[model samples]
Target: MDGEPVDARWGSARVRGRRLRTVRAHAFAAAGLLLAGCASMPDSGEIRAVQASQGVDSQVRVFGVPPADKATPAEIVDGFLEAMTSDDPQLETARKYLTPAAAKSWKPSSAVTVLSSGLSRVAVRGEKDPEGPRWKVTGKKLATVDEHSAYQPQTGAREYEEQLQLVQDEDKQWRISTPPSGLVLSESDFQRIYMPVNKYYFAGGTLVADPVYVRQRTDPDSRMDPTTQTVQSLLAGPSRWLAPVVESSFPTGTELRTGTKSLSYDGQNTLRVPLNDKVGNIAQPQCKKMATQLLYTVKDLTGSRLDQVELLRSSDDKTSSLCSVTSVSADAIANRPKIPEFQYFVDNEKRLVRMKLDVSSEDQQTRTEPVPGPLATVPVFKVSSAAVSHDERRAAVVSEDGHGLYVVSLVGGGPMPAQVPIGRGGKAETLTAPSWDASGDLWVADRDPQHPGLWRVPGGTGTPERVQVAGLDNRRIVSLKASADGARIALLLEQDANSRILYIGRVERPDAKGDVSAVSVRELRPAAPQMADVTAMSWAPRGRLLVVGREKGGVQQARYMLADGSMVAASLPGATGLSEVAVAAAEDESKPKPVVAYSEDGIVWLPPGAQWRTVAAGGRSPVYPG
Candidate 1:
């Protein structure tokens, strides 16, 4: 349904009243059945009658239809609004209360305003102009579902007021003529009619997907298909807020081969996708990426009904030239470069050590002694945090005093030179841990409240340049991590009252120069909004995030969250007192990888089995090469 603001006080009483009635009804039904002597021997006709009664009762729970032709203007408006909550395909019943012209033009799915229960009320002003009448709707707006169906939570008590205009038809029936383009539904109806799904996009040069909620027809035979809608929405590109940071492999102007036709499946449970000619020019690598995006998106929407996707130039094409794609883990996509197999962490002596994974062993344990880094031999300032470059040949270190950032090569046996300085020179109040993007550039936030800014330095010897980021005014960046693909950057922002918030932004770089010029930050919903502080975050496989934080009055904890802010229940429960977290994406998409976290006790690791194991007695700042 389309937009209207929600009222916090709306529908609550109604819901409670409904629940009471349901409990009473069930109690009475049970009692009646127990008292009936033939309850155990009820005839087929009797059972059918009881079932029919239940069906009617369920329909009544959703509210009955509004008055028809003889209904007043207020009645018609109320009925139309109520009808918006129905599961009728195309909202055909909701249209009955509108003029034919208005019915044909109204677009209910454009947006949705979710309101609190028991607080919505309509006020009707008499027919001032005789030719038309107007009504006002007031409520608290909890969140808004935009055209792309992304649910954005409102920051405060958002009260909304809408003016609706109505006209009379030739049959003398009152009807709404100028209804709002979007729909307004109670939170309950929204949950029943809408679902959240992720659309794949490339982040940090890797194929990752972000979740966006979309409305789906609840009817069993509606022409509107959720799978087709999802595919079309993905082709439409990422939501406006995320567009700047994520890239879509789909070519411009690409669309389903048959427009609105529902996806078809073969006997083998393979989805057949037909694409327009826009994809004809895409190179094989890009085509595969596109296929991967579609596969994940469609699989999510269809409950994994199809195991593979076959792309055709057009629906009519029967030739073998069409591309076929099988279901594979997101990690298997060829676009993302391979990460180094070794894990790195800082030891008690402030020295970097590497633990190599035994790929050939069934246990996948690190049996060899931890190798000290080449930089350990060189005299350097006390290190607080470090980031390994994407190529695994270099590392960036932040001084313990948060005054300087330095880069050191990790390869070669010769004594290493002093750490190379990068970024603005003067001492700052706080310097976040450094991060390396795909281009080998180093990024770190200078947390000087008076002049807080983000900076990018070239992989080699260029000076660090300040990068302007929108929507970061008056806030200190606590920590920053750039996605391996270089498309998105995640920042831990410290706000007033020691509140630590997480934000994701798009990174814009100059075409010729490798330095970043701007970053665009967008509001993000975290999986754990109640967390009082966010200590660490890292990108994981399948577009998930490994977030470590603590709720107010709670112990430190870590959880996985999808890009759209939904919590993933994938277990990693036993580890505790985590100070830093790291994840390594596996080469095989289907294989689960362990997540390493540095806790107060030591270096604790959570493998795929959700059990924690100690890797070292005194380690901190664990990391996997980007």
Candidate 2:
């Protein structure tokens, strides 16, 4: 029977006398008989054993209950708030707690206010209203999901307060007269109802992943499932934070064909998307790009394999063929990072060294060897920290004194190249570790007290240009990591002894005919505001950061977080006491490389589903290819 209310009038009816009591007893007897007829325990059967659930039940679904008769004003307000968190497809049950006019005007999908816990509802003692009683609902806001499905987290726990008025209906039953416009849910409820999905867009020639949230099932207001809703959000362009750096291939007004409500895969494991006439006349190349974006965005939504995505355009009330892209063709358009052959680090001898990746067995003691280039044969200064290029052909090394930066070749033998002068003259411990973006450009930060700034070297071989960081109020960038897509950068900054913050900024450049000198960092938003201290971080696959830090009044640990500032269900199982950590930026994330870190035990490697094991006894600054 799916366990829903068959009839609720029995609870709302007003009746009296012994005859009504007898009717209630008869109704209860009839229900017992109906349930008994379905199944009965075999009292004399032989005993048998069955397996019990091994873990907590995750598939439990919540249903809303109707209000009791003669409910008080506070009860009405509290019931409405509880009903908002239930998974009602159309939210009709939640509307039952509201007045007719208020129900009609309330739009739950307008926005979502997420709190750390359930809201507190209390009666206003001295309020005087002619037609209703007043109650207050308040919470500490943690985040908000906008109408566009973008998840934005707030730094501080801001106060959120609203008033709910209760009035009597024609039958004199209490109901909420005024209701909030959007859904106010606790953090646990929000996680259960919504899921995180990525939409693809172009940043210059590379594809970037923009993370957003969508309802887990059919949306209450839109009536569209998660796949269709994600595609619609993709056509609406990137989020406001990412709109400045990325562009969508879809046309300005392009949308799903009219009256489309759901999207599914065909027998060939292919998805065919129908678009409106606005994109009917696009070229094959442009159409392919659009299909590629859709293929990546919705590939993981369903259990079935998504091998290809074909676009169908409407013309004269008839659908015609547009271009299509397969999984193979999409890779050419998306510039994902290449798999690295080895993980690099600074050894006890202060030289750049490497060890083979994907170690197949526990008994396999892979030997560590020096790199094949000048950094191995003709070293000039002691190496403190380093970053390998995405292609694994070159490495950027910082001097042990932390005042010089040099780019060294790892594949070809040559003399050690001259240090890239970043103009941080004569200052000790001024230069941070160097990082390489997917476009082959190098980035570094100078924390010199006199000239604190960020510098980018064009092509890793050109003059360094100091980039201006917006919204950095008297803070110095201490460490930095540019994303493999070259569209975003993560920075660890400090303002004083007590102020340490981690921020992710959008990398912007002017359209002055490919002028690389005009590049600057803009819109530095907090990436890990929940933590009080962030010691180390590196760019991980799928546009995430592998962070090492601790929350306020907590101990240090390592965890992974999305670049959009949303939490995920991922963290190092027992990786503690880590001073630094690194993750490989590979294209295929299904089989990730081992996490490399440096701790009190020296260089440690954490293979998937295994405890951390020491590799080198005296190594510091372990790193992977960007």
Candidate 3:
């Protein structure tokens, strides 16, 4: 009874005149009943059968295992590399191409080198031997995803090569006996199997998070639990690219408690994480901070399944609560200062004026008047760029002539002073815009190629001191912006070919008190490699960067990019021919932070809807208080 009418058309045809009309009506009613029956829900057995079919189809590996009996050494090596792309739970299918002992000892989590697509090659080294044969694989390396799944731009070696040793088992089957500890995959495969996860760290003594890519497995029985793996990676600390800048509260050697199986969610959707004895020594404040880190990391992995984090400390075969907290109270552990809602710029009159940001309104327009201050009375000439202090009471400005750097009080009482000289000749060859750090120190870079270097002044006063920047030799710094967190600095360097590159360097201060003698810059990492000329850049909320630049064959545009070199397309339709960009990094949760740029048309702003609204005509440099 598959809910279909039986011979209704025949009945209508056989009936005569008036009887025929009635017969057709009955046939129509029967057809409606048939459709109604078909619309009913399927039985439990039928539903289960459909779900089973879908599950099996999804479990099919991306790379299939090939018969090894007739495969060559080079073929085995290629197969093993291809198998790394599979999402097979424990990678058991990948293990089939490896010798039993090698498979057991191999650690794919050690590292991952993302190779350029269509550039990989495998070569057999020599003739086959009784044990097996050897092969060499090489490709162009794009980036390195470390053990913690943190990505770093490949700096030195452009080409990657590895030696693979294969052996034949008793059944005469080819298998990899001595493969590399880590795995290599194509760029497309890496994107398909991995996702970005941010790990929180403290910057300028305030809590902040940095993004890193982590592998996401589809198999329920995968060897590594994604939730637990994420927490462990966070404890491992920031990537090499960012470690020098950010600080992690977690002590060295922190790990999950022994005998703990996996991270689990309880009835209330709270995540219970039991850690080793190392956490027993952490103070109450630090314990809560650690809990905050765990909460964010786990929530990102499990989505809304986790509401809070309950940390348990294991000792004497017993577990006890270290701390428990939610995302709401996490701010109590952070010492971040409030950022101003107004945007400031030097007017055509050479006076400083601010425009208030009304994020609530549909237009999101700026206020009409500027705040009254000493800057209004002071005569600032040809201002190229200005950086507002963290307190919003002071500003540091650089002159267009590239000679003088001056600090001026924003509140109306301070005396108008002379320009701070940057070099020995009472003139700077070229001076970058000055930046104020949380500690009230001002930093600038001298673009003099003969003696190119970075300099720091105490609160934008006193004699400038040279800072040692590692790996900055032979490159000219065109622009510099110090991050509000005070842990890193963004630099625009000009290469020999006249191409501009964006780099982030970790700022290291001296340990000894009053030791302004020297500061070190280390672990420099590239942020935007595709841009041929970067006109301007600024830091955005959550450690992202707002960059304005032109690609090789593209028009100039502004876009957001993560610290790990991932691009986020923020549409600014009317913002073209942009010269500079700035962001408030507003802490307000109720409204979207405002971003402004100086386009050829005028000063344009991009608000919540990504629409470019004009702020002022003929405005040059736009900035927000740190």
lDDT of 2 at 333: 82
Clashing pairs in 3: none
Question: Which is the leading candidate under lDDT?
Answer: 2
After TM-score superposition, what is the CA distance of residue 426 in candidate 1 from its true location, in Å? 8.9
Q: How are the candidates ranked when ordered by TM-score, highest leading?
A: 2, 3, 1
Cα RMSDs of all predictions? Answer: 7.2, 7.9, 12.9
What local lDDT score does residue 65 receive in model 3, on the 0 to 100 scale?
52
Which 10-residue span in candidate 2 carries the lowest summed lDDT?
Answer: 10-19
Where in model 3 is the C-alpha error above 4 Å? 1-75, 125-132, 208-210, 218-222, 244-246, 259-271, 296-308, 316-318, 362-366, 378-382, 423-429, 448-451, 461-463, 512-517, 566-577, 580-591
1-626, model 2: which lDDT tens digit per residue? 12121221111122111001222334565564221110011122221211111111224344455666887565566567767866666787688899999889989998999876556655653224564577777777888888778888876558988888777899988888778889987776677678888999988778898988888878887789989999989998888888878888999999999988899999998999999998978988888889989998999777889999999998777887798999888878876677678888888888888888855655423667787888877444478889899899999998887888999888888788899988466747888888888889999999888989999998899998889899888798889988888889999998578656789998987742254558888888788877788888887767778888778898777878877776754888665667644333343364687788888877778877778877777777777776
Q: lDDT tens digits, residues 220-251, model 3? A: 23355667667778888877666655667777
lDDT for each residue of candidate 1 in 1-626, tens digit (9 for 90 to 100): 02333232333433222211222344567575322111111111222222211221222223224345477665566666666766666777677777788889988877888765323445455655654667777766667878776766665667877777877777777888777777887666666566678787876556655667665643322354778778878988887766665678888899876544577678997877778877776777777778778887877565546677777675345323356677754337735645566777777876667776543344433452433455666573357677887677887877666667777777765554455444344555367778886677788887765567888787644677777777776677787777766766788877666568776776665641244544433444443454677777887765566777777887767777665553342435763655544433332234455677777766666667546667777767777765
Best by TM-score: 2
lDDT of 3: 0.66
lDDT of 2: 0.76
